[model samples]
Target: MSYEIKKQRILELIAEMVEIDVNEVKEDSDFADLGIDSLMALELAVYLERDYNIFIKEHELMNLRKVEDLLSFLKTN
Candidate 1:
């Protein structure tokens, strides 16, 4: 998939997990700052794994501070 499409899908998963609107998730938005608690983080990991086949490690999740981080990762690896 393209970068934009992957980014949008990531944001959509996050938004759906947090019950927020997709427009609310900016490229630089931090999940912790956006009120994503531990439970939500786990949900995101699972969703990404199932949807995109990206097996996210707990520490890797820490690196995913913003949507751009995810996009970069997806693009590179």
Candidate 2:
């Protein structure tokens, strides 16, 4: 899939996980600011790994502070 499509899907996934509207998920917003705690972040990682066939290490999870960070990681990996 294209980067933009994947990015939008990731945002939608995050919005669903957080019980918020997709429109509220800003690309540059911190996950914490979007009400996504560590557990939620981990859950997101798990979902991505499972559904997208990608693996994410715990250390990498720590670096995903913002939506853009996560998107960038997904883009390259």
Candidate 3:
């Protein structure tokens, strides 16, 4: 998938998880700022891994603190 499409999907998933509007999720927005706790982050990682057919280690998931971080990871991996 294209970067923009992947980004939008990720934002939508985050917004759905946090009960917020997708438009509120900026590329630079921190996951914590979006009200994502550790469990939520893990759940998002699972979704990303399943949807994108990629595996992400726990430590790597922990490091994805911002939307951009996840996007970059998705792009490269």
| Candidate models: Cα lDDT each | 0.79, 0.90, 0.89
What ranking of all candidate models by TM-score puts the best one first?
Answer: 3, 2, 1
Model 2, global lDDT? 0.90
Task: Kindly report which residue pairs in candidate 2 clash with one another.
Answer: none
Query: Candidate 1 at 67: error in angstroms?
Result: 2.6
Window of ten residues with lowest summed lDDT in model 1: 65-74
Please provide, for model 3 over 1-77, each residue's C-alpha lDDT reduced to its tens digit, 9 standing for 90 to 100. Answer: 78788888888999999999999999999999999999998898889778988688999989999999988898888
Model 1 spans with C-alpha error above 4 angstroms: none
Tens digits of per-residue lDDT for model 1 on 1-77?
67678788888887887788999988788777778887777787787788788887898877777767766777776
Top-scoring candidate (TM-score): 3
